[model samples]
Target: MLLGEELRLIAYNTAIKHNITTSMVHKGLYQLGVSGCPWKDADIVEALGDLGDYGVHNLFAVERIARISEVHPYSRVKGLLYHSYESLGVKERDENGEFIAPKLLWKENFFNRNERGEGNAP
Candidate 1:
């Protein structure tokens, strides 16, 4: 089991490398249950819920979103972060039932918006 300080360091490093907030990294680790972390699934769900629409768009935030989908398939998190699902390799279909490639959607929504600083919502 990892110590709290160790976990904090991991979160900090991940935040620095990913260009995301430390809080987001900490929350993601808690959600992922790194080293037997005590945070429950409900806690993770609530944390993600508090992030709102724009917060969910952050690059690091996608990890937590994907974790939620893996643990809870019927979760509202999936619907909330629908666009992110594609980026995380989750399959998505258009209204016409045609496959929508995650790479294209990721480039258009994440990378492009990131270049414009539109994804950096406060």
Candidate 2:
């Protein structure tokens, strides 16, 4: 299989100009949440800045799962975690009221199902 970069090169391009550039679209598709390359939260913030009112819960989920997968023996975590956004200290927005992403914590507690369980760590 081609890597994210490779797939990106072959992806269809409308060549529209904006912060939501073709590159961002490609990255969103192939590299956003996986063991492809280093993707920063700032980039997500930039590409999705216009989507301020939009809830970014799904994107963070992929990011955290990928981070955990990178450390663990598998690429897909098979278990559930109990950590909440509050417990992980993840605020889903920046001070400017723009949408910020919650990153993954590399804690065993992130993967274990606690009595107060809610959802994934990110």
Measured on C-alpha atoms, candidate 1 has an lDDT of 0.48
Q: Which candidate is the best by TM-score?
A: 1
List the lowest-lDDT window of 10 residues for candidate 2.
73-82
What TM-scores do the predictions have? Answer: 0.33, 0.24
Q: What global local distance difference test value does model 2 have? A: 0.39
RMSD of each: 12.8, 14.4
Question: Which regions of candidate 2 are displaced past 4 Å?
Answer: 2-29, 32-56, 81-122
Q: List the residue pairs that clash in candidate 1.
A: none
For candidate 1, the 10 contiguous residues with the lowest summed lDDT are 101-110
Q: Residue 83, candidate 1: how far off, in angstroms?
A: 12
lDDT per residue as tens, model 2, 1-122: 45555544433232232324454444443444333434343333233322222333334434653443343322222322224434444454568988654344333544463334844543
- Point out where model 1 deviates above 4 Å: 34-60, 63-89, 93-122
How close to the true structure is residue 23 of candidate 1, measured as C-alpha lDDT?
73
What digit string (tens of lDDT, one per residue) describes model 1 on residues 1-122?
46678656655554454445667655554434432323454444344444433455344454545444453443444345535555645555668989653221233444566679776322
